[model samples]
Target: MPLSEYEQRVLEQMERQLSSDDPKLVNTFQGRASHGLRRWVLVSLGALVGLTVLVLGAATSNPLVGVLGFVVMFVSVVFAFSPPRRGGPTGVVGADGEVRRSSPPARPPRSSGLLQRMEERWDRRRDERGR
Candidate 1:
C-alpha cells in the first residue's frame, strides 16, 4: 500500500535528519566512486610485471633477481590496497622543539550495532501498533 501523506512527510523529515547527522551515510547512498579506473589499471600492470620478473628470475636460478621480483610484487600489492592519503601537514614542531605527528580525524562513535538498532526500531513499531 502507498504511504499516506503524513507518512511521506515523516520519512522525508527522517531522511533530512539522517543526512545532516551523517554526511557519510548520504554519500554512501549516492554511490560515489572511491577510486578511479586509472589506479586499478596501473596496479594491475605492476602486478603483471612483477609476476613476469618473478618467473624469469626463477627460470634463471638467480636468487637475487627472484628476491627483487618478490619485493616488487609486495610493494605493488601494498600500493594497490592502501587508502589514498589526505592532504595535510605530516608533522609540526612544538615550542619545545619536539616533532609531533598529525593524528587522523576522529570518527563518530557508534552507539549500537545494526542488529540492535533494527530490533529497537521493530520493538518501537510493535508498541505503536499496540497502542
Candidate 2:
C-alpha cells in the first residue's frame, strides 16, 4: 500500500537527514535511484546480448560463445567490485565540519578450533568450582 501523507513526510525527513549527513554518498546514490530509463536500457541490452549468445552457442554447437558470455560477465563483476576513487569526498563528518573519509577497519584472523573453545569453557567452570 502507498504511504499516508504523514508517513511520506517522515520518509522525506529521513531522506533529508541522510543527504545532509553524507552529501557525497547521497549525490552518488541519487543518480542511480532515479535512473529508471538508464537502468531499463542496461537490463534490456544485457538480456538481448545474453539471448543472442545463447542462441549462437546452441546453433553452432560451440562452447566459444558460452565462454565469451562467462568472460563478459566476469569482467563486468570485476569492474563493479573495484573500489571507488579516494579523491572523492568521504561521507564522515568531523567536529570541525570537515569530511573525514576513512576506510573500514581490517578484521581479526580466525581463532582456534571448537575443541579449544570447549576446553576454555571447561577450564573456566573448573576455576569457578574451585573458587
Candidate 3:
C-alpha cells in the first residue's frame, strides 16, 4: 500500500535529519561511480590486449613473445584486483601551509531491525485503538 501524506512527510523529515547528521552516508547512497572505475576499465582492456597477443604468439610458435604476453596479463590482473591505495590526509590547509585537522563525525546508533519495527508499530496501533 502507498504511504499516506503524513507518513511521507515523516519519512522526508527523517531523511533530512539523516542528511544533516551524516552527509557522507547520504553521499554514498547517491549512486555515483567510484574513483577507480576508469583505472579498472584500462586494466581490463590491457588484459584483453595481452590475451590477444598471447594467442598470436602461440600460433606463430614464438615462446618469448608468449611469455611476455603472459607476464602482461598477470600484471594487469593483479593491478586490477588490488585494493585501492589511501594516498594522504584530506585536511584543510591554512594560508601558512599548516594542515587543519578536524575530528570525525560521531556515528548514530544502529536502528532497530525489521521485527522490532513491526512490533513497535503493532504496539503503537494497539495503544491508539485502546484510547
Q: Among all windows of ten consecutive residues in candidate 2, which has the lowest summed lDDT? A: 79-88
Q: Score every model by TM-score.
A: 0.45, 0.35, 0.45
lDDT of each: 0.70, 0.64, 0.73
The best candidate in terms of TM-score: 1
Checking candidate 3 for backbone clashes, the offending pairs are: none
Candidate 1, residues 25-57, lDDT tens digits: the string is: 454444435454666777888888888889899
Task: Output the lDDT of residue 39, model 2.
Answer: 49
Which candidate model has the greater lDDT, 1 or 2? Answer: 1
Give per-residue CA lDDT, model 2, range 9-126, as digits (tens). Answer: 8877776576556667654653444455554555556656766776777689889897676555555445445554434565554444455555654597765989988998999999
Quick one: best lDDT, which candidate? 3
RMSD of each: 12.3, 9.3, 10.5
Superposed model 3: Cα runs more than 4 Å off:
1-34, 91-131
Best first by lDDT, ranked: 3, 1, 2
Model with the higher TM-score, candidate 2 or 3: 3
Global local distance difference test of model 2: 0.64
